[model samples]
Target: MERSQPNYRLIYHDIISIKCPGKKEECSPILNKKEISILDVIKLNMIIFGINDKETQIFNQKHRSYDESTILEILDYQAKNNLNNTQLANHFKLSRNTVAKWKKHFKNKHLHPVKAN
Candidate 1:
């Protein structure tokens, strides 16, 4: 079994599982599901943004799928403006993973403002 780091439950899980007898295995399938698929994530994002079926277009012509590379710039822009992913996602009505995909694209160190000599 792959044990998650300590405090993972405290920090990440918002719901507590109430296991009942043999249902232990299925008690919290969301946790067991682990990785989320890209397509499902996109659909969730569309719903979050309220685009649904009404919107034919997704991304703008200037850019493509929120590719890993371009997402870095978006993350930096969000951080430089002192916005957390959750806040930005809520404000923009985007999914946390969609915002997180961009955040994961770049390590934080490189984004820091270089100090003048």
Candidate 2:
């Protein structure tokens, strides 16, 4: 079965008609049919809903990067609980390689505190 594309004209009308809360001016300009694309509608919807992909990605990455204290906590949990790399990764929502890398770094830091460079 073929899927029907969304009605861009109706979407454009709805978007242009939306009134900004507590403001008298129109929400946005009425775009010409030739000027509006699917991407433009998607961006307009995102703006209306306050959903920003770029900001979401930055927030996600910031939380994903483990801090020194978090790394130590992971190491301590692994050692005390006898969890394997895969288990630790699953429990913490991290990749197996990340878990292994943290374990290696923890060991290296304790064994060799001073680095040449």
Point to the candidate with the largest lDDT.
Answer: 2
lDDT of 2 by residue, 87-115 (tens): 77767557788777776677754332321
Instruction: Report model 2's TM-score to 2 decimal places.
Output: 0.40
* Cand. 1 Cα-lDDT: 0.46
TM-scores of the models, in the order given: 0.35, 0.40
* Native-structure RMSD, model 1: 14.3
RMSD values for the candidates in order, in angstroms, are 14.3, 16.8
> Candidate 2 — worst ten consecutive residues by lDDT sum?
108-117
The lDDT, on a scale of 0 to 1, for candidate 2 is 0.56
Best model number under TM-score: 2
Clashing pairs in 1: none
Q: Worst 10-residue stretch by lDDT in candidate 1?
A: 11-20
Where does candidate 2 stray beyond 4 Å? Answer: 1-63, 108-117
Give me the displacement of residue 115 in model 2, in angstroms: 25
| Candidate 1 structure quality by residue, lDDT tens digits, 1-117 | 975433422322332333233333433443345553333334333433435452444343123345443455555556666777777666555667777655554566346532211
